[model samples]
Target: MIQNNAYIELMKETKQLENSVSKISLRLKTDQQLIQAFLDGNKESIGILVERYQRQLYFLCLRILQDHEDSLELVQKTFIQVMEKLYTLQNHNSFKTWLYRIALNLCHNFLREKQNYNKALSHLSLESSGSFNDPVIQEEQSLLLKEFLEELTEKQRNAILLRIYHNLSYQEIAEIMDCQEVTVRSHFHLGLKKLAGKLKKCGLTL
Candidate 1:
């Protein structure tokens, strides 16, 4: 009986050690490493990758779609698509940008089908206004910024949002946008110039 109890305790300790080692291995894995692991038939690695990026992708979709339900749906669809097409991905290091590209393409297609530009702007305006805590000054500033954003072309707005809100570099933005770096720079700078002009008119500086 004592030997039996000792064997059970040893088994428990071994299991605990295995769990700790698994967790440490997961923590040490980079995105590319996770992707490779998934490709190598470790199904759980894909779930880890999803957990790492799902929140960021959801917010990116929400900012573009401006609807919670749509954003949620898009995030699910994005992951599904990623899982289905991951094998075709040539550059594992570009997984993040590739993921964003998929999500953005889905957003663009949805927006195009809806064809409700004015409705989207209205939603954006409301979101902007609600973001401010100060009832007076912040509200006014938000409204002004919303108006400036409304005037920008789609490419210009996207470039500005990706750069400012996401803190993405020009090269990364270009990769996600599937555009030239120079084009992204032009759109961003032109958008900024327009914003500056609008802010100057209101005695504010960007």
Candidate 2:
């Protein structure tokens, strides 16, 4: 039954959203401590850092990528990339931003590749059987919000994610995103416009 199926889907999505919120709220920044340990050339620190960021990070990457293996691979690749670039940790203060940038870049690349593959598979199935589909769209509002986010520019997408998901400040976002405060502001505006347009297109509005 459509009703039963929708109900089941709603329950699953609710559970996933609750878990994601709890995961992200956990002490997010073991960044500096990890950096200190990493700078000392202790490989264990790299593992520790990955453990600290793995949850919300997977959530973040998962949002942008395929629902199944992409998140797992991105999280692992993010850690590996950080380990290889460990010597570049100029300031422990910027570790969170730095780690995010690396992860973000990887997510974008994965999304690009995934999109190409998705196109090839579109004729095979209109339903998204890929694991990379949005996982947080439980309620009507949450579903709408996810749709709005999908319409955002990449920069806007990252800005909103950093602000809401990662809980980074504007200054911190600027540093991680490698942009000025004004550009951060601009991205927010552009992102908002795009989201609003999508809402209008979807016959939904904030």
| Candidate No. with top lDDT | 1
Colliding residue pairs in candidate 1: none
Give the per-residue lDDT digits (tens) of candidate 2, residues 133-188.
34442244455655456545668877876776667888888887899978987897
Estimated TM-score for each candidate: 0.83, 0.66
Lowest lDDT 10-residue stretch of candidate 2 = 120-129
Q: Please give, for residues 15-78, the per-residue lDDT of candidate 1 as tens digits.
A: 9999888867876799999899988988878888888889999888888789999989999999
lDDT of each: 0.84, 0.68
105 in model 2: Cα distance from truth in Å? 0.2
Worst 10 residues of 1 by lDDT: 123-132
Compute the lDDT of residue 91 as modeled in candidate 2: 83
